[model samples]
Target: MNKWKIILDYFLKFLTALILIFLTLIIIFKFTIFNKNYIKNNLKENNYYEKVYDSIKENMENYIISSGFSENILDNIYTNKDVEIAINNYIDIIFSNKKDKIDLSKIENKINSNIDEYIKDQEIKILDKDSITSLVDDLLKIYTNEIELYNMFDNYINLFSKLQTILNIALICLLIITIILIIVLIKLKIQNLGIIPFTSSLMLLYIRFLIYNNIDYKNILIITDNFSNCLVQIVTKIVDLILICGIILGVMGLIAIILDSRKKNKKKE
Candidate 1:
Protein backbone atom coordinates (compact mmCIF):
# COMPACT_ATOMS: atom_id res chain seq x y z
CA MET A 1 0.00 0.00 0.00
CA ASN A 2 2.82 2.41 0.88
CA LYS A 3 4.65 1.70 -2.38
CA TRP A 4 1.47 2.12 -4.46
CA LYS A 5 0.72 5.42 -2.73
CA ILE A 6 4.22 6.68 -3.51
CA ILE A 7 3.76 5.77 -7.18
CA LEU A 8 0.43 7.57 -7.28
CA ASP A 9 1.95 10.71 -5.76
CA TYR A 10 4.72 10.77 -8.38
CA PHE A 11 2.17 10.32 -11.18
CA LEU A 12 0.11 13.22 -9.90
CA LYS A 13 3.20 15.45 -9.79
CA PHE A 14 4.05 14.59 -13.40
CA LEU A 15 0.51 15.37 -14.54
CA THR A 16 0.53 18.65 -12.61
CA ALA A 17 3.72 19.78 -14.37
CA LEU A 18 2.24 18.99 -17.80
CA ILE A 19 -0.92 20.88 -17.00
CA LEU A 20 1.04 23.93 -15.89
CA ILE A 21 3.08 23.95 -19.08
CA PHE A 22 0.00 23.63 -21.28
CA LEU A 23 -1.86 26.35 -19.43
CA THR A 24 1.10 28.75 -19.79
CA LEU A 25 1.22 28.16 -23.56
CA ILE A 26 -2.48 28.82 -24.03
CA ILE A 27 -2.31 32.05 -22.04
CA ILE A 28 0.69 33.27 -24.01
CA PHE A 29 -1.02 32.61 -27.34
CA LYS A 30 -4.21 34.20 -26.14
CA PHE A 31 -2.44 37.45 -25.26
CA THR A 32 0.07 37.61 -28.08
CA ILE A 33 -0.46 36.13 -31.57
CA PHE A 34 -4.17 35.41 -31.14
CA ASN A 35 -5.00 38.99 -30.27
CA LYS A 36 -5.35 40.52 -33.73
CA ASN A 37 -6.93 43.82 -32.76
CA TYR A 38 -4.29 44.39 -30.10
CA ILE A 39 -1.46 43.93 -32.58
CA LYS A 40 -3.04 46.36 -35.07
CA ASN A 41 -3.58 48.90 -32.38
CA ASN A 42 -0.04 48.50 -31.16
CA LEU A 43 1.33 49.07 -34.67
CA LYS A 44 -0.63 52.27 -35.08
CA GLU A 45 0.21 53.42 -31.57
CA ASN A 46 3.91 52.94 -32.24
CA ASN A 47 3.81 55.17 -35.36
CA TYR A 48 4.63 52.19 -37.55
CA TYR A 49 2.21 53.45 -40.18
CA GLU A 50 4.08 56.71 -40.52
CA LYS A 51 7.41 54.93 -40.76
CA VAL A 52 6.05 52.72 -43.55
CA TYR A 53 4.91 55.81 -45.43
CA ASP A 54 8.40 57.27 -45.10
CA SER A 55 9.96 54.10 -46.50
CA ILE A 56 7.55 54.13 -49.46
CA LYS A 57 8.31 57.78 -50.14
CA GLU A 58 12.08 57.11 -50.06
CA ASN A 59 11.68 54.23 -52.53
CA MET A 60 9.50 56.34 -54.82
CA GLU A 61 11.95 59.23 -54.72
CA ASN A 62 14.79 56.91 -55.68
CA TYR A 63 12.71 55.64 -58.63
CA ILE A 64 11.84 59.15 -59.86
CA ILE A 65 15.48 60.22 -59.57
CA SER A 66 16.65 57.27 -61.65
CA SER A 67 13.77 56.97 -64.20
CA GLY A 68 14.97 59.82 -66.51
CA PHE A 69 11.85 61.93 -65.88
CA SER A 70 13.62 65.06 -67.23
CA GLU A 71 16.10 66.86 -64.95
CA ASN A 72 14.17 70.08 -64.25
CA ILE A 73 10.87 68.35 -63.40
CA LEU A 74 12.68 65.88 -61.19
CA ASP A 75 14.60 68.76 -59.67
CA ASN A 76 11.40 70.60 -58.79
CA ILE A 77 9.63 67.50 -57.42
CA TYR A 78 12.56 66.21 -55.43
CA THR A 79 13.96 69.57 -54.37
CA ASN A 80 10.60 70.75 -53.10
CA LYS A 81 9.85 67.31 -51.58
CA ASP A 82 6.38 67.54 -53.16
CA VAL A 83 5.91 63.79 -53.50
CA GLU A 84 6.93 63.22 -49.89
CA ILE A 85 4.21 65.50 -48.58
CA ALA A 86 1.65 63.99 -50.92
CA ILE A 87 2.52 60.45 -49.88
CA ASN A 88 2.44 61.43 -46.23
CA ASN A 89 -1.03 62.97 -46.62
CA TYR A 90 -2.27 59.92 -48.47
CA ILE A 91 -0.97 57.65 -45.71
CA ASP A 92 -2.69 59.76 -43.08
CA ILE A 93 -5.96 59.32 -44.98
CA ILE A 94 -5.42 55.59 -45.15
CA PHE A 95 -4.89 55.36 -41.41
CA SER A 96 -7.83 57.60 -40.55
CA ASN A 97 -10.44 54.94 -41.38
CA LYS A 98 -13.20 57.56 -41.27
CA LYS A 99 -15.13 55.63 -43.90
CA ASP A 100 -16.12 52.00 -44.24
CA LYS A 101 -14.70 51.62 -47.74
CA ILE A 102 -11.43 53.32 -48.61
CA ASP A 103 -11.90 55.08 -51.92
CA LEU A 104 -8.97 55.73 -54.22
CA SER A 105 -10.56 59.02 -55.22
CA LYS A 106 -10.31 60.25 -51.66
CA ILE A 107 -6.59 59.55 -51.63
CA GLU A 108 -6.20 61.06 -55.11
CA ASN A 109 -7.97 64.23 -54.05
CA LYS A 110 -5.83 64.51 -50.91
CA ILE A 111 -2.62 64.08 -52.89
CA ASN A 112 -3.81 66.51 -55.57
CA SER A 113 -4.59 69.12 -52.95
CA ASN A 114 -1.14 68.75 -51.40
CA ILE A 115 0.53 68.83 -54.82
CA ASP A 116 -1.27 72.03 -55.81
CA GLU A 117 -0.09 73.75 -52.66
CA TYR A 118 3.41 72.39 -53.18
CA ILE A 119 3.58 73.74 -56.74
CA LYS A 120 2.21 77.14 -55.75
CA ASP A 121 4.54 77.53 -52.79
CA GLN A 122 7.65 76.34 -54.60
CA GLU A 123 6.82 78.15 -57.91
CA ILE A 124 7.77 75.12 -59.97
CA LYS A 125 7.34 74.79 -63.72
CA ILE A 126 5.97 71.57 -65.18
CA LEU A 127 3.88 71.40 -68.35
CA ASP A 128 2.18 68.00 -68.01
CA LYS A 129 -0.18 67.92 -65.00
CA ASP A 130 -1.78 64.85 -66.56
CA SER A 131 1.58 63.08 -66.62
CA ILE A 132 2.09 63.69 -62.92
CA THR A 133 -1.52 62.68 -62.26
CA SER A 134 -1.08 59.49 -64.24
CA LEU A 135 2.11 58.60 -62.36
CA VAL A 136 0.44 59.12 -58.98
CA ASP A 137 -2.59 57.10 -60.09
CA ASP A 138 -0.40 54.21 -61.19
CA LEU A 139 1.53 54.20 -57.92
CA LEU A 140 -1.66 54.32 -55.87
CA LYS A 141 -3.17 51.47 -57.86
CA ILE A 142 -0.07 49.34 -57.38
CA TYR A 143 0.11 50.12 -53.70
CA THR A 144 -3.53 49.28 -53.04
CA ASN A 145 -3.46 46.14 -55.18
CA GLU A 146 -0.64 44.55 -53.16
CA ILE A 147 -2.94 41.88 -51.80
CA GLU A 148 -0.05 39.91 -50.31
CA LEU A 149 0.67 42.66 -47.83
CA TYR A 150 -2.98 43.16 -46.90
CA ASN A 151 -3.58 39.43 -46.82
CA MET A 152 -0.96 38.93 -44.13
CA PHE A 153 -3.13 40.92 -41.76
CA ASP A 154 -6.35 39.38 -42.99
CA ASN A 155 -4.96 35.90 -42.49
CA TYR A 156 -3.99 36.63 -38.90
CA ILE A 157 -7.43 38.00 -38.10
CA ASN A 158 -9.14 35.04 -39.73
CA LEU A 159 -6.89 32.54 -38.00
CA PHE A 160 -7.54 34.01 -34.57
CA SER A 161 -11.26 34.01 -35.13
CA LYS A 162 -11.20 30.43 -36.34
CA LEU A 163 -9.22 29.27 -33.34
CA GLN A 164 -11.34 31.17 -30.84
CA THR A 165 -13.83 28.34 -30.32
CA ILE A 166 -11.18 25.69 -29.88
CA LEU A 167 -9.15 27.86 -27.55
CA ASN A 168 -12.20 28.56 -25.40
CA ILE A 169 -12.92 24.86 -24.94
CA ALA A 170 -9.29 23.98 -24.26
CA LEU A 171 -8.85 26.80 -21.80
CA ILE A 172 -11.81 25.66 -19.74
CA CYS A 173 -10.67 22.05 -19.69
CA LEU A 174 -7.10 22.91 -18.77
CA LEU A 175 -8.23 25.23 -16.00
CA ILE A 176 -10.43 22.51 -14.54
CA ILE A 177 -7.62 19.99 -14.76
CA THR A 178 -5.25 22.40 -13.02
CA ILE A 179 -7.66 22.90 -10.14
CA ILE A 180 -8.33 19.18 -9.71
CA LEU A 181 -4.63 18.40 -9.78
CA ILE A 182 -3.92 21.01 -7.13
CA ILE A 183 -6.64 19.63 -4.85
CA VAL A 184 -5.52 16.05 -5.35
CA LEU A 185 -1.87 16.92 -4.66
CA ILE A 186 -2.80 18.69 -1.46
CA LYS A 187 -4.91 15.76 -0.34
CA LEU A 188 -2.03 13.39 -0.98
CA LYS A 189 0.23 15.57 1.20
CA ILE A 190 2.56 16.13 -1.73
CA GLN A 191 4.34 19.42 -2.52
CA ASN A 192 2.77 19.83 -5.97
CA LEU A 193 2.31 23.60 -5.54
CA GLY A 194 6.04 24.14 -6.13
CA ILE A 195 5.74 22.23 -9.43
CA ILE A 196 3.28 24.87 -10.71
CA PRO A 197 5.76 27.72 -10.58
CA PHE A 198 8.72 25.54 -11.59
CA THR A 199 6.88 24.37 -14.70
CA SER A 200 5.88 27.97 -15.53
CA SER A 201 9.51 29.09 -15.41
CA LEU A 202 10.55 26.23 -17.65
CA MET A 203 7.79 27.01 -20.15
CA LEU A 204 8.82 30.70 -20.26
CA LEU A 205 12.42 29.73 -20.91
CA TYR A 206 11.32 27.61 -23.87
CA ILE A 207 9.19 30.42 -25.24
CA ARG A 208 12.10 32.87 -24.98
CA PHE A 209 14.34 30.42 -26.79
CA LEU A 210 11.86 30.03 -29.64
CA ILE A 211 11.43 33.78 -30.00
CA TYR A 212 15.16 34.29 -30.25
CA ASN A 213 15.74 31.43 -32.67
CA ASN A 214 12.78 31.67 -35.06
CA ILE A 215 12.73 35.37 -35.93
CA ASP A 216 15.13 36.11 -38.78
CA TYR A 217 16.05 39.72 -38.15
CA LYS A 218 17.81 40.10 -41.49
CA ASN A 219 14.83 38.90 -43.47
CA ILE A 220 12.51 41.12 -41.51
CA LEU A 221 14.74 44.14 -42.15
CA ILE A 222 14.89 43.34 -45.85
CA ILE A 223 11.11 43.36 -46.00
CA THR A 224 10.94 46.86 -44.47
CA ASP A 225 12.79 48.49 -41.61
CA ASN A 226 9.58 49.93 -40.27
CA PHE A 227 8.00 46.49 -40.25
CA SER A 228 11.06 45.09 -38.59
CA ASN A 229 10.85 47.71 -35.88
CA CYS A 230 7.19 46.96 -35.29
CA LEU A 231 7.89 43.24 -35.10
CA VAL A 232 10.61 43.82 -32.54
CA GLN A 233 8.35 46.00 -30.46
CA ILE A 234 5.63 43.39 -30.38
CA VAL A 235 8.06 40.59 -29.68
CA THR A 236 9.63 42.66 -26.94
CA LYS A 237 6.25 42.98 -25.30
CA ILE A 238 5.90 39.21 -25.32
CA VAL A 239 9.38 38.78 -23.93
CA ASP A 240 8.67 41.24 -21.19
CA LEU A 241 5.60 39.28 -20.21
CA ILE A 242 7.62 36.08 -20.21
CA LEU A 243 10.28 37.60 -17.99
CA ILE A 244 7.74 38.91 -15.54
CA CYS A 245 6.02 35.55 -15.26
CA GLY A 246 9.35 33.75 -14.90
CA ILE A 247 10.50 36.04 -12.11
CA ILE A 248 7.24 35.67 -10.22
CA LEU A 249 7.24 31.91 -10.60
CA GLY A 250 10.89 31.56 -9.68
CA VAL A 251 10.32 33.55 -6.48
CA MET A 252 7.21 31.60 -5.61
CA GLY A 253 8.94 28.29 -6.17
CA LEU A 254 11.92 29.34 -4.09
CA ILE A 255 9.67 30.39 -1.25
CA ALA A 256 7.74 27.15 -1.42
CA ILE A 257 10.94 25.06 -1.30
CA ILE A 258 12.32 27.09 1.60
CA LEU A 259 9.12 26.69 3.56
CA ASP A 260 9.01 22.97 2.80
CA SER A 261 12.62 22.65 4.01
CA ARG A 262 11.82 24.51 7.22
CA LYS A 263 8.84 22.23 7.88
CA LYS A 264 11.08 19.19 7.44
CA ASN A 265 13.74 20.69 9.74
CA LYS A 266 11.10 21.35 12.42
CA LYS A 267 9.88 17.75 12.12
CA LYS A 268 13.46 16.51 12.56
CA GLU A 269 13.95 18.74 15.62
Candidate 2:
Protein backbone atom coordinates (compact mmCIF):
# COMPACT_ATOMS: atom_id res chain seq x y z
CA MET A 1 0.00 0.00 0.00
CA ASN A 2 2.87 2.41 0.74
CA LYS A 3 4.50 1.61 -2.62
CA TRP A 4 1.18 2.20 -4.43
CA LYS A 5 0.77 5.59 -2.71
CA ILE A 6 4.31 6.60 -3.73
CA ILE A 7 3.56 5.69 -7.32
CA LEU A 8 0.39 7.77 -7.27
CA ASP A 9 2.28 10.79 -5.95
CA TYR A 10 4.86 10.54 -8.70
CA PHE A 11 2.11 10.18 -11.28
CA LEU A 12 0.42 13.32 -10.06
CA LYS A 13 3.71 15.26 -10.20
CA PHE A 14 4.32 14.05 -13.72
CA LEU A 15 0.87 15.23 -14.76
CA THR A 16 1.42 18.62 -13.16
CA ALA A 17 4.74 19.04 -14.98
CA LEU A 18 3.12 18.21 -18.30
CA ILE A 19 0.41 20.76 -17.67
CA LEU A 20 2.97 23.43 -16.78
CA ILE A 21 4.86 22.79 -20.01
CA PHE A 22 1.71 23.34 -22.02
CA LEU A 23 0.80 26.41 -20.01
CA THR A 24 4.17 27.99 -20.74
CA LEU A 25 3.76 27.39 -24.46
CA ILE A 26 0.29 28.91 -24.50
CA ILE A 27 1.42 31.95 -22.55
CA ILE A 28 4.35 32.52 -24.87
CA PHE A 29 2.17 32.29 -27.93
CA LYS A 30 -0.52 34.50 -26.46
CA PHE A 31 1.94 37.36 -25.98
CA THR A 32 3.96 36.83 -29.14
CA ILE A 33 2.90 35.25 -32.44
CA PHE A 34 -0.83 34.95 -31.75
CA ASN A 35 -1.11 38.57 -30.72
CA LYS A 36 -1.80 40.99 -33.59
CA ASN A 37 -0.38 43.98 -31.76
CA TYR A 38 2.87 42.12 -31.12
CA ILE A 39 3.35 41.64 -34.86
CA LYS A 40 2.53 45.27 -35.59
CA ASN A 41 4.99 46.36 -32.95
CA ASN A 42 7.68 44.23 -34.48
CA LEU A 43 6.97 45.67 -37.90
CA LYS A 44 7.38 49.17 -36.55
CA GLU A 45 10.57 48.25 -34.76
CA ASN A 46 12.04 46.79 -37.96
CA ASN A 47 11.17 49.82 -40.08
CA TYR A 48 9.01 47.57 -42.22
CA TYR A 49 6.79 50.37 -43.46
CA GLU A 50 9.69 52.40 -44.81
CA LYS A 51 11.25 49.39 -46.48
CA VAL A 52 7.92 48.55 -48.07
CA TYR A 53 7.65 52.04 -49.49
CA ASP A 54 11.12 51.76 -51.00
CA SER A 55 10.30 48.35 -52.48
CA ILE A 56 7.16 49.73 -54.08
CA LYS A 57 9.08 52.59 -55.64
CA GLU A 58 11.74 50.21 -56.91
CA ASN A 59 9.14 47.89 -58.47
CA MET A 60 7.33 50.85 -59.96
CA GLU A 61 10.55 52.04 -61.57
CA ASN A 62 10.80 48.74 -63.42
CA TYR A 63 7.32 49.14 -64.86
CA ILE A 64 7.98 52.78 -65.74
CA ILE A 65 11.17 51.94 -67.64
CA SER A 66 9.37 49.19 -69.60
CA SER A 67 6.48 51.55 -70.38
CA GLY A 68 8.93 54.05 -71.99
CA PHE A 69 8.14 56.67 -69.34
CA SER A 70 10.67 58.65 -67.37
CA GLU A 71 11.19 57.25 -63.89
CA ASN A 72 10.83 60.78 -62.57
CA ILE A 73 7.14 60.47 -63.26
CA LEU A 74 6.91 58.01 -60.35
CA ASP A 75 8.28 60.60 -57.92
CA ASN A 76 6.05 62.04 -55.20
CA ILE A 77 3.16 59.77 -56.22
CA TYR A 78 3.13 58.19 -52.78
CA THR A 79 4.84 58.64 -49.46
CA ASN A 80 6.04 56.37 -46.66
CA LYS A 81 2.99 57.47 -44.67
CA ASP A 82 0.68 56.11 -47.38
CA VAL A 83 2.45 52.78 -47.32
CA GLU A 84 2.20 52.61 -43.51
CA ILE A 85 -1.54 53.28 -43.59
CA ALA A 86 -2.20 50.66 -46.27
CA ILE A 87 -0.12 48.03 -44.53
CA ASN A 88 -1.73 48.70 -41.14
CA ASN A 89 -5.20 48.51 -42.71
CA TYR A 90 -4.32 45.18 -44.28
CA ILE A 91 -3.02 43.88 -40.95
CA ASP A 92 -6.23 44.94 -39.21
CA ILE A 93 -8.26 43.10 -41.84
CA ILE A 94 -6.22 39.94 -41.41
CA PHE A 95 -6.62 39.99 -37.62
CA SER A 96 -10.33 40.77 -37.85
CA ASN A 97 -10.85 38.03 -40.45
CA LYS A 98 -12.34 40.45 -42.95
CA LYS A 99 -12.28 39.85 -46.70
CA ASP A 100 -12.07 43.50 -47.60
CA LYS A 101 -9.61 44.67 -50.20
CA ILE A 102 -6.98 47.28 -49.33
CA ASP A 103 -8.01 50.68 -50.53
CA LEU A 104 -5.65 51.90 -53.24
CA SER A 105 -7.77 54.83 -54.33
CA LYS A 106 -5.36 57.44 -52.99
CA ILE A 107 -2.41 55.85 -54.75
CA GLU A 108 -4.35 55.45 -57.98
CA ASN A 109 -5.48 59.05 -57.95
CA LYS A 110 -1.99 60.32 -57.24
CA ILE A 111 -0.48 58.23 -60.04
CA ASN A 112 -3.12 59.31 -62.55
CA SER A 113 -2.56 62.95 -61.70
CA ASN A 114 1.22 62.59 -62.01
CA ILE A 115 0.90 60.86 -65.40
CA ASP A 116 -1.43 63.56 -66.73
CA GLU A 117 0.94 66.29 -65.65
CA TYR A 118 3.97 64.50 -67.08
CA ILE A 119 2.31 64.02 -70.45
CA LYS A 120 0.96 67.55 -70.62
CA ASP A 121 4.29 69.12 -69.69
CA GLN A 122 6.33 67.00 -72.09
CA GLU A 123 3.76 67.28 -74.91
CA ILE A 124 4.23 63.59 -75.60
CA LYS A 125 1.82 62.48 -78.30
CA ILE A 126 3.01 58.87 -78.63
CA LEU A 127 1.25 57.86 -75.39
CA ASP A 128 -2.51 58.29 -75.81
CA LYS A 129 -5.11 58.52 -73.01
CA ASP A 130 -5.82 54.75 -72.98
CA SER A 131 -2.13 53.84 -73.01
CA ILE A 132 -1.37 56.21 -70.16
CA THR A 133 -4.34 54.84 -68.18
CA SER A 134 -2.93 51.36 -68.60
CA LEU A 135 0.44 52.51 -67.32
CA VAL A 136 -1.22 54.07 -64.28
CA ASP A 137 -3.08 50.84 -63.60
CA ASP A 138 0.12 48.82 -63.80
CA LEU A 139 1.94 51.14 -61.40
CA LEU A 140 -0.89 51.01 -58.87
CA LYS A 141 -0.93 47.24 -59.12
CA ILE A 142 2.72 47.12 -58.10
CA TYR A 143 1.96 49.12 -54.95
CA THR A 144 -0.96 46.88 -54.05
CA ASN A 145 0.96 43.68 -54.58
CA GLU A 146 3.89 44.94 -52.54
CA ILE A 147 1.60 45.72 -49.64
CA GLU A 148 -0.40 42.45 -49.80
CA LEU A 149 2.58 40.15 -50.41
CA TYR A 150 0.39 37.85 -52.52
CA ASN A 151 -2.17 37.39 -49.74
CA MET A 152 0.01 35.11 -47.65
CA PHE A 153 -1.91 35.80 -44.44
CA ASP A 154 -5.40 35.41 -45.92
CA ASN A 155 -5.41 31.62 -45.93
CA TYR A 156 -4.36 31.38 -42.27
CA ILE A 157 -6.63 34.01 -40.74
CA ASN A 158 -9.57 31.70 -40.13
CA LEU A 159 -7.37 28.89 -38.94
CA PHE A 160 -5.56 31.24 -36.58
CA SER A 161 -8.83 32.52 -35.17
CA LYS A 162 -9.96 28.99 -34.38
CA LEU A 163 -6.63 28.02 -32.90
CA GLN A 164 -6.56 31.13 -30.70
CA THR A 165 -9.95 30.28 -29.25
CA ILE A 166 -8.89 26.70 -28.63
CA LEU A 167 -5.65 27.79 -26.96
CA ASN A 168 -7.51 30.11 -24.61
CA ILE A 169 -9.87 27.33 -23.58
CA ALA A 170 -7.02 24.88 -23.15
CA LEU A 171 -5.02 27.32 -21.07
CA ILE A 172 -7.90 27.92 -18.69
CA CYS A 173 -8.61 24.21 -18.30
CA LEU A 174 -4.96 23.40 -17.70
CA LEU A 175 -4.68 26.10 -15.05
CA ILE A 176 -7.59 24.67 -13.12
CA ILE A 177 -6.26 21.13 -13.42
CA THR A 178 -2.79 22.19 -12.31
CA ILE A 179 -4.18 23.89 -9.22
CA ILE A 180 -6.23 20.82 -8.32
CA LEU A 181 -3.23 18.55 -8.85
CA ILE A 182 -1.01 20.69 -6.62
CA ILE A 183 -3.66 20.66 -3.90
CA VAL A 184 -4.00 16.91 -4.06
CA LEU A 185 -0.24 16.44 -4.01
CA ILE A 186 0.01 18.64 -0.92
CA LYS A 187 -2.78 16.74 0.79
CA LEU A 188 -0.93 13.52 0.07
CA LYS A 189 2.12 14.92 1.90
CA ILE A 190 4.20 15.13 -1.29
CA GLN A 191 7.03 17.49 -0.37
CA ASN A 192 8.68 17.91 -3.79
CA LEU A 193 6.24 20.46 -5.21
CA GLY A 194 9.22 22.23 -6.74
CA ILE A 195 9.79 19.25 -9.04
CA ILE A 196 6.76 20.17 -11.15
CA PRO A 197 8.08 23.64 -12.01
CA PHE A 198 11.66 22.41 -12.34
CA THR A 199 10.58 19.77 -14.85
CA SER A 200 8.48 22.27 -16.78
CA SER A 201 11.34 24.74 -16.97
CA LEU A 202 13.66 22.08 -18.34
CA MET A 203 11.06 21.10 -20.91
CA LEU A 204 10.70 24.69 -22.10
CA LEU A 205 14.45 25.13 -22.32
CA TYR A 206 14.83 21.94 -24.33
CA ILE A 207 12.13 23.00 -26.77
CA ARG A 208 13.80 26.37 -27.23
CA PHE A 209 17.15 24.74 -27.81
CA LEU A 210 15.70 22.47 -30.45
CA ILE A 211 14.04 25.30 -32.35
CA TYR A 212 17.12 27.53 -32.22
CA ASN A 213 19.45 24.83 -33.46
CA ASN A 214 17.22 23.20 -36.09
CA ILE A 215 15.68 26.18 -37.82
CA ASP A 216 17.76 28.42 -40.09
CA TYR A 217 15.62 31.40 -39.31
CA LYS A 218 18.34 33.96 -39.94
CA ASN A 219 18.45 33.41 -43.67
CA ILE A 220 14.76 32.85 -44.21
CA LEU A 221 13.65 34.18 -47.58
CA ILE A 222 10.04 35.15 -47.97
CA ILE A 223 8.24 37.17 -50.68
CA THR A 224 10.55 40.20 -50.71
CA ASP A 225 13.81 41.14 -49.05
CA ASN A 226 12.12 43.76 -46.91
CA PHE A 227 9.45 41.34 -45.80
CA SER A 228 12.05 38.68 -45.19
CA ASN A 229 14.07 41.03 -43.01
CA CYS A 230 10.99 41.84 -40.96
CA LEU A 231 10.24 38.13 -40.61
CA VAL A 232 13.74 37.38 -39.41
CA GLN A 233 13.57 40.15 -36.84
CA ILE A 234 10.23 38.94 -35.55
CA VAL A 235 11.46 35.36 -35.35
CA THR A 236 14.61 36.36 -33.50
CA LYS A 237 12.55 38.36 -31.05
CA ILE A 238 10.28 35.37 -30.43
CA VAL A 239 13.22 33.07 -29.81
CA ASP A 240 14.81 35.50 -27.40
CA LEU A 241 11.52 35.86 -25.55
CA ILE A 242 11.33 32.10 -25.20
CA LEU A 243 14.82 31.92 -23.81
CA ILE A 244 14.08 34.64 -21.26
CA CYS A 245 10.88 32.97 -20.09
CA GLY A 246 12.60 29.60 -19.82
CA ILE A 247 15.39 31.04 -17.72
CA ILE A 248 12.93 32.84 -15.47
CA LEU A 249 10.96 29.68 -14.83
CA GLY A 250 14.12 27.70 -14.24
CA VAL A 251 15.31 30.21 -11.64
CA MET A 252 11.96 30.17 -9.91
CA GLY A 253 12.00 26.41 -9.75
CA LEU A 254 15.54 26.36 -8.40
CA ILE A 255 14.71 28.86 -5.68
CA ALA A 256 11.63 26.91 -4.69
CA ILE A 257 13.65 23.69 -4.47
CA ILE A 258 16.36 25.35 -2.35
CA LEU A 259 13.77 26.74 0.02
CA ASP A 260 12.06 23.36 0.27
CA SER A 261 15.40 21.69 1.05
CA ARG A 262 16.20 24.21 3.79
CA LYS A 263 12.82 23.70 5.40
CA LYS A 264 13.26 19.94 5.36
CA ASN A 265 16.78 20.28 6.87
CA LYS A 266 15.43 22.48 9.70
CA LYS A 267 12.67 19.97 10.42
CA LYS A 268 15.24 17.18 10.61
CA GLU A 269 17.37 19.21 13.04
Top candidate on lDDT is: 2
Clashes of each: 0, 0
- TM-score of candidate 1 against the unseen true structure: 0.65
lDDT per residue for candidate 1 within 88-190, as digits (tens), equals 4433433332223334565566556656665777777878878777867755554443312433443344444557667878999999988887887778787
- Could you give candidate 2's per-residue lDDT for residues 50-150 as a string of tens digits? 88888888888877877866887887888898889899999888777788998878778877777778778889786367887787788878888889997
**Backbone clash tally for model 2?**
0
TM-scores for every candidate against the unseen true structure: 0.65, 0.92
> Which segments of candidate 2 are over 4 A away from where they belong?
126-130
What RMSD does model 2 have? 1.9
In model 2, the worst 10-residue window by lDDT is 126-135
